[model samples]
Target chain A: MSYKAIQLIKRPSGDLTPDIFATVELPRPVLEEGQFLVRQTHMSLDPAMRTWLQEREDSYIEPVQVGEVMRSYGVGEVVESRNPDYPAGARVIGITGWAEYVLGNADMQVVDPAIDPEALLSVFYMTGLTAYVGLIRIGRPKAGETLVVSGAAGSVGSLVGQIAKAEGMRVVGIAGSDEKCRWLEEELGFDKAINYKSDNLGGQLDEACPNGIDLYYENTGGVIQPLVFERMNRFGRIVVCGMISEYNRDQPTPGPSWVDINLKALRVEGFVVVDHQDKAQEATEALAGYLQNGQLRFRTQVLEGLDSAIDGLSMLFRGDNTGKLLVRI
Target chain B: MSYKAIQLIKRPSGDLTPDIFATVELPRPVLEEGQFLVRQTHMSLDPAMRTWLQEREDSYIEPVQVGEVMRSYGVGEVVESRNPDYPAGARVIGITGWAEYVLGNADMQVVDPAIDPEALLSVFYMTGLTAYVGLIRIGRPKAGETLVVSGAAGSVGSLVGQIAKAEGMRVVGIAGSDEKCRWLEEELGFDKAINYKSDNLGGQLDEACPNGIDLYYENTGGVIQPLVFERMNRFGRIVVCGMISEYNRDQPTPGPSWVDINLKALRVEGFVVVDHQDKAQEATEALAGYLQNGQLRFRTQVLEGLDSAIDGLSMLFRGDNTGKLLVRI
Candidate 1:
């Protein structure tokens, strides 16, 4: 049997086009001993994927070698299993790829599908744990404190703002468009949402956070992140979850002078969810509680088929999507 | 009786010149209730002093206005005391100024000159506390780990190296000159010292820190700090005490991309010594024990008189001093 897969033929310089990858029919990967075959149904498109596709050195995960199937976190059904542990037709998620089927030996966790597919892939997979870890576990904004979240329209940023608001923090969000900003304030209960694309971002940010920022959830680093950094109160924490602004450029645009970090006494830290999977069970339970209580809300912008993954990713940079932008294959 | 004081006449654009300050002699203020008169003897010339003189809005301490006495950490002898809390002819240290005398009503701790003058001011005042808080209290390097320190020949950096050495960590120093590097390695028991002024800083840092940097005591920011930052291992901590390199610039120099901080999952934090003065007594007792045990050693570059304050501060950027650069009156 043969299956279609997106293979990385060449690395893009800045803007990624579909030509960088090619859809090819290949023999189905055979399951080895204690291995299973996953027929991937959906692939989570992320900003970090832009980093993975670039010609660069090693990151949190190994770089996808040329000629290899492109890397992605995928949700799929277990079609065949050589191991007694995973029976056939088991729904699971793991480090699959932009392929129709994945054959691997890594342990796959069964997805409950208690949440819908898009939410499961967006909230539970990459975005939820990211927000949970950075905002709750790391940033730890106290009650009545002013917390700022950048990329407010994005899946992770929205969740971060919602959770922080639920925890009694006065939450502010920075997004690219006024519409996105309104959604964040009205739908997600963000205290204020500043349009980063506007001319008076600095003025708006200052007005939004009069007492100065206590905790900054830095999702997109650019002019906006630096403006926020300057206003950070003493002992403020910067949970650097992503730098989506820099990911697509050949060279990242220079950020604001970090002299503020030194003079104001700030703590800037970065983390990834995959590295702290142990927090998965705890984060999931907490997030589930938020969902059940209606204190938490999420949105997903699903695109049709694996072919749309390339264009869906560009939405992140352009702020074209309102929430989790995913490719439903 | 009157004494001379250096007052900032104008805010500097970038580089500080002697023209910005004027030595004006004024009649001594009559001692008021609960006030003590301090005959300022020796003042600490620090990088942060540049920040205080800059045309900035605010920092850890309020910026020294253009016509005010230059803000500094000063040691002086109390010649007159009305409060009875401090006796006459008592030595004390406080946030005085670049002046011959300071009239204030704050609690003044009596100084015991058991240590030499410059060493006493350097090893026991703000410099000493800064090293202690950043290295021991914050960085918290465990045994057998490699600790890399930038500005390693300066007051705080040298102390950081010695303290880390005493803690049983392999210590590497980054200084501007070969002579300073030798002094750090030979006299202070640093495992290695990299000459940042040399062309091979990257190779030297790599050679010195073979296992990669576990903790980086960042006293100065610019070229040297970024080089050290590049070599830091995962989970490494950066103790940001000062950024002397950017202090004199109109627009602060941009450092390396923070993508490294994210990729390596590093913690880059900034702090001021004054904020943690409560740790002063505790740090003093511990540091005093190190000095007594000869596990800690220090050097001082002392200018002859108070007139030297203007030119004396230049020694920091030009790297003309070794341990503590002080103006001895």
Candidate 2:
């Protein structure tokens, strides 16, 4: 039997195109002793994937080496198992390379879809946790405090705003489109939604949060970042999750200088979800409760077939997606 | 009797010169109810004073207008008082402008030099308290951890190194000269010292801190900042006390386009000593004990004569002195 896979043939000079990824067929990976073979189901398409495509080093994960299958956290079903640790019918979540099938050690977790169907919280093992750890652990929002989340309609950003609100803090979302902003405010119950592309962020922030922001969840860093910093209250906490705005630009991103951070006495921190693996189970439990209770809602712009994975990933850099972009295989 | 004061004749256009201030004679201020008249004894010369003179919109304290006395924190002796709370002949510290005599509210603390004596800890009210709050409240260094302190031999920076050592952490100091570096390593018990002016910081940091830095006490910002960020350990904390490097620049400071802060998963926080006033007594007692036990030492670069206030303040921007720079009357 043969399997199809996406491989990074050459490092891209700047933007990722068709030439960078090669669709090829190979003999299905064979399972060795203490290993299970999984047929890929859904691959997570994240903005961070764009960072990996570039040859530069990021904070948490390493860049994808040429000739190697693109690195991604995927969900798959066990098709064959040489190890008794996983059964044939089990669904697992693990660090699997971007491919039609993954063969690896039985270290992956076999999930109970009954407990979390569609692996909504499991896929979160990456995006959900990124939001969870960045906000709860790093930002540390207190109840009744105002939390301003930029890119609040995207995967991690949406979850961040909702989770903060669930914790009894006021949540305001900033997005690019009117539709995304409306959905975030009406459906997600965000206290305010400011479309960054159309609105004067500084003015909107002042109007939305009259008192001033106590916690800032930054996902898109650029001009808006400086404005948010200017409006932060004394002793405000900031969690720098991503800079989706500058991801695609060939030139350098221009962010407001950090002078305000010093004078205003703000706490600005940057973190990757992978570093908080120790608290993954706990975060999953708490986030899952929100999902199960209907207090939290997640939207995935599903692109069917593995062929669209590249486009889905690109959309994140372009600020095109309304929620989590998932590639269904 | 009347005394001369250095008044803010004009807001500075970047670099401060002698022409920005004008000498003016005024009648001695009279004490009102709940207020005291203090005869200025010593004035603190800090780089932060530069920000106050720029007429900046982002400044926490209002910029001094034309014909106003230069704002500063000075130690003064109360010669007359109407408030029952504080009596005459008391030494107090507060936001008393740069004048020979000041009329201030009784809300400011009266420092009893007879009780505490002039020791290393006496400066704890300002410089030393800044170090304590930045380290304990912000950096949160643990035992066996390594701390890197920039501006390492200056007032607050020097105390931060010694305090980190007392907490059982390895301390590294970064200063402008070999003399200051020697003072940090030899006299202050710092594990290592890197003179940013001479040595290759990256290579030197590798040799000095083999395990990497866990806590960074950032007193200087500009070229030295990225170097420190590059070597920080995962989850490292940086307490930004001041950025003296950009204090005197005539142009807007250009920060690194790509801040590796995200990749390092570091925390950079800014704090003011005045905001941590709630812990003043606690920090004072602890620091005083260490000084009395001969475990802590402090240095002061006393620029003689009140007439030398302008020259003393200028030394901070030029990096001409070490420890706390003070103007004695």
What DockQ does each candidate score versus the true complex, computed on alpha carbons? 0.57, 0.49
Q: State the displacement of the C-alpha of residue B198, model 1, in Å, after optimal TM-score superposition.
A: 2.6
User: If scored against the real structure, what TM-score would every candidate get?
Assistant: 0.93, 0.90
Docking class of 2: medium
Candidate topping lDDT: 1
Per-residue CA lDDT of candidate 2, range B1-329, in tens?
89878898886766678888877888987656787788887788887888888765546777778889988877878888887666788878878788899887645687766753233223567777888888988888899999999888888888888888988999999999999989888998999999898757789988888898788888888677777776778778878899888777666465444334565677888987777888878888878776777667888777766668887777887789887887777
Candidate 1, residues B1-329, lDDT tens digits: the string is: 88888888998777778898999988898988788899888888998888877655446778889789888887888888887767788778788887888985475577775646577777887888889999998888899999988899999899999999999999998888899989998888899988876887788888888888889888777777767877888788888888888888777776666676776688888888778989998999889999999988888888888879898887787888877888888
Show pairs that collide, candidate 2.
A59-B263
Q: Rate the local accuracy (lDDT) of all candidates.
A: 0.83, 0.79
Error in Å for residue B155 of model 2: 1.1
Candidate 2 residue-wise lDDT at B70? 87
TM-score for chain B of each model, two decimals: 0.95, 0.93
Q: How far off is residue B45 in model 2, in Å?
A: 1.9
